[model samples]
Every structure is written in C-alpha cells, then in structure tokens.
Target: MKKTVTILLFLLINSLVFSQSLVDLSKREKERRARLKGKTIIIQKGGDPARKGATLKTDPSGLAEETEGLDDLTSLDRESPPQKRMIPKTENPPEETGADQKDATDLQKLEEQLRKAKEYVELLTLKMNALWQEFYSMDDMKSRDEIQRQISETYLNLQKAQANEQKLQKDVEAR
Candidate 1:
C-alpha cells in the first residue's frame, strides 16, 4: 500500500511538469517546420522574387538557361584578341615642378591666422547680435549700460579681426 501511494505521487508530479512544458515544445516545433517549409519553397523557386507578393507559380528554370547564355558569351570574349597601343611622354613647363616647401609652410601659417581671425569675428558678430537683441527687447535705461558695453567690446573685436586679416593677406601674397 505504501509503494502504491509513492508511485501515485510521482506520476502526479510528472504529469504537472509535462503539462507545463507541452505548450512551449509544440510552439517551437511549429516554428521549426515553418522555417523548413520556407527554405524548401525558396530552393524550388531559385532566387528570391523581386516583389514580396510575387508567387513561385511561374517557371523557375530560367536561371539555368541564363547561365548557358552567359557561358557562351564568356567563351566568345576569350576567343577574341586584345589590342595593343603606343604612347609617348612629353616635357612641360617649369610650373610642372612642385611648389616650394617653405611656401607651403607659410600658406599653412596664414590659413591658421585667417581661421583665428574669422572665429574672433564670428564671436564679435554674435556679441553684437545679442546686444542689439537686448537693446530692442528692453526699454529706456534698463538695458542701456550692458548694451553699450557689448557694442564697445564688439567694435574692438572687429578691429582686431581686420588687422589679423590684413596680416594674413600680406603673408599669402608674399608667398
């Protein structure tokens, strides 16, 4: 009687475990079979269709025919001989010589100076914009002092940028 009760308990536990696992197992098997079917269908139809909705009902044996034509064209190309050509070299002017390395260094330096000047000018322009915006937005004496200070700073920056630009132009011309 004790052995019978123990066997019954084991069977009940086993049934519960199997019941929980059955759903997942069936879902996995279904998905696997679906993927297999898709592969079989793709192989039957040669390459994938141009459009998603296109069917494999049309003749799929055209791929073999196309390959046969390609083979014939390749053979024809192999039978033909390539052409030969004669070429001549010519001498050119002194400009053909590369530019001086010193000139290149000077050009790079001038470019750096120009970039710096442009950046300063852009900052000054932004400051001027902000000052104008503040002046227009605020009334009477409220924004007067700050706006005046900003305008003076912007004018100084513009002058500095102008000087730098002139120096860069001289350097470039000298080069």
Candidate 2:
C-alpha cells in the first residue's frame, strides 16, 4: 500500500509539472498566432504550407504605396547619366608608394584599435554601474565587498581603456 501511494504521488507531481509546461507552450503559441494573424503568408512552390517558419507576406495597404517611393528613386538612378571618372587619363598613372600604403594601413589599424578601446570602456562602465546597484541591494557583507572590488577593478580598466583611446585619437589626428 505504501509503495502504491508513493507511485501515485510521483505521478501526480509529474503531471502537475508537465501540465504547467503545456499551459505555457499553449500561451506562447496563442501569442505567436495573434501576432501573425493579419499578415499574409507566401507559400513556396515546393514547400509545405503547414511547415513551421517565417512566412513572407505582401503589404496590401498604404504601406505598399509608401514603398513605391523607393521604387521611383531606383528608377531615377537608372535614368540619370553616368558619372565621369575623377582621375584624368595619362600615359603613366600615379601609383601608391610602399610607405604610403603602410601609412594608410597603420592609420586604419589605429582607428580600429581606438574604436575597440572606446567600446571596452563603455562596456566596463556599464558593468561597474550594474555591480554598484547589486552591491547596494545585497544584504551580506562578504558579497557586497566582493561586488565592490569588482566595481573598482572595472572602473580602473575603463579609465585605462579611455586613456589608450585618447592617445590613439591624438596619433590619428597628428597624421
């Protein structure tokens, strides 16, 4: 009798968990259906319409008319005359020297490095702010101390990255 009761209890708990998941899945399906209800669906030639995926739909409303403006812009581009070349034809065309190419490559690398450094600083600043908030809301002293140390480290890294970015910017400007 005890074994039977135990098995029944297990089955009841399992059903409860599965039923909750089913309810959640149905809710999500309803929401997805509602979102796609009014949208038109395009069925591919060899594709099954019953398949689950994104369906392309043509806009039948004023939105379609609004896109006609973009079509007109494209048409205008086709109607316009071709642009003339900026460089004049000569017997010997000017070529880029090795040093010029190297300088250009170095400038691009510096610009990219500076952009990465700035992004790093911004990410660090965001992390520091989030850690600060977490530290304030914490009830434990040890956790708060750990979060505070993380905030300090992140802030220091942010300052270093910002300094490096400034130096790279100056180098770029000097060139």
Candidate 3:
C-alpha cells in the first residue's frame, strides 16, 4: 500500500510541475492562431492619419468653428475704455466690533478651561496609578480597601475631566 501511494504522489507532483512549465513564444503564438482560426479578425486603425500632419483633436472631423457674429478678431486690440483709479488701502486696520471681541474672550476662556481639564485628567491618572501600586504593596486588608476606594474616586474624577475637556474642545472648535 505504501509503494502504491508513493507512486501516486510522485505522479501528481510530476503532473503539476509539467503543467506549470512556461511554453515557448512560438508555441503560444501557434496555439493562439489555432484557437482564432475559424473567426474573421477585424483590426481597425484609429486616430488622425499620420501623413496629413493635422493635430489630433477630440472634436468631430468635419465640424468647423462658428464664424458668425465674430465681426473681426482684431477689434479687441484697437482700444478699451479708461479704467477707474484703484483706491490704495490705508494701513490702519478696522476696529473690532463688540461681538467679535466677546467671541475672542470666550474662545480664550474655553481654551483655558480645556487646558485645565487636561491637567486635571493627567493628575487623576497619576493618582490612580499610585493608589493601585500602593494597594498592591500594602499587607493590611483595610489599607488596601482604602486605597481601592481612592482609586475608584480618582477614576470617576478622570472620567469627568475627560468629558469636560471634550466639551470645551468642541466649544473652542466652534469658535
């Protein structure tokens, strides 16, 4: 049984190897021609004729540009009406309106709030990490419970700070 299986496996591998071998160009061309033998192959040449030296244009071959109402092409070059003198701008900038000033102040305040929120979040994260470390190191069950409670409070505060930061960011972006 092993001998028969080995022979079959050898035959399968040999068949796969032979099937994957690249054929010569001449053989490929002969096979292509044989497959196309019974059909009439029409080869259509496209684009502008080479000998005519005409530019290759996408417009229809026979359509000419409209010459009517054009009158004369050089009429534009004769003369034009005199243009108005341009007013040079003064360098002194326009004063900001009260609303604009208020908006600027609001944006500054929101930016400050966002910065504070980020700092608060960072502080809470550091406190929580420290509490967790202390909780893990403490031998007393009561102290560990206390540290865990503090960690939970810090986590809640961090969540609030993150939410406030997001809100402030949105307000700042809106400005």
Residue 8 miss distance in model 3 (angstroms) = 60
Judged by whole-model lDDT over C-alpha atoms, candidate 1 comes out at: 0.52
List candidate 2 stretches off by more than 4 Å.
1-94
Model 3 per-residue lDDT at 171: 86
TM-score against native, each model: 0.39, 0.46, 0.46
Ranking by lDDT: 2, 3, 1
Q: Tell me the spans in candidate 3 whose CA falls farther than 4 Å from its real position.
A: 1-94
Q: Which candidate is the best by lDDT?
A: 2
- Candidate 1 has its poorest 10 consecutive residues by lDDT at 71-80
**Model 1: number of backbone collisions:** 0
Error of 3 at 174 (Å): 1.5
For model 1, residues 1-175, the per-residue Cα lDDT tens digits are 9999999999999999998899889999777555444221111121223312212222333222121112111111011111122335456523423557566656876876665555555545555676777778877785687677657766776687778778887777787
List the global CA lDDT of all models.
Answer: 0.52, 0.60, 0.58
Q: Which stretches of candidate 1 lie over 4 Å from their true place?
A: 1-99, 140-142
